[model samples]
Target: MSCSGCSNAVNRVLQKKEGVTSVDIDLEKQSVLVKTDDAVSYDDVLATIAKTGKKVNGGQVIA
Candidate 1:
């Protein structure tokens, strides 16, 4: 994201999800780091971000 507003918007959207415990946005890298639990599905996260009207380059679950 280019600005704080973009980051905030992403933060808000992801925070509302069921298993998203935290969200960290790196504006310089234009990346979002989401911490989620087992109950959350990757598809759900992708769909949630999609609602923000932002193009997702790609994502993968870590650990």
Candidate 2:
């Protein structure tokens, strides 16, 4: 994200998700780290991010 407001916007939206446990946004790296339960799918996360009107350049599942 470009600024703290952008990060906060993303953080707020992701934090509202049902299975989201935590959210870490790395402004320097322009990336977001989200921790979620098994019920949360990769697509679900992506869609949630999209809800913030941010263009997701890419994403990957750690496990």
Candidate 3:
């Protein structure tokens, strides 16, 4: 993400997903930290980010 707008876009999109509990975008790191329940899948989260039209350079699950 480039700016607050970019982060907001990610936040808005991810928050609408089925099991996304929260979304935190770190513009500096160009990363999105998404919190979800067990019901959510990585593909679902990726698809949601894809909907925002932002290119994901990289990503990983914390646990």
lDDT of each: 0.89, 0.94, 0.85
lDDT of 3 by residue, 1-63 (tens): 788988888898888888899887778878788999998888888888999898877777777
Per-residue error (Å), model 2, residue 22? 1.0
Best by lDDT: 2
Which lDDT tens digits does candidate 2 get at residues 22-61? 9999999999999999999999999999998999999888
Residue 11 of model 3 has an lDDT of 91
Model 1: lDDT equals 0.89
Tens-place lDDT per residue, model 1, 1-63, is: 789988888888999998999998999999998989999988899899988888789999997
TM-scores for every predicted model: 0.92, 0.95, 0.88
Instruction: Estimate the overall C-alpha local distance difference test score of candidate 3.
Output: 0.85
Structure candidate 1, residue pairs in collision: none
RMSD of 3: 1.1
Q: Give Cα distance to truth, residue 59, candidate 2, Å.
A: 0.9
Pairs in clash, predicted candidate 2: none
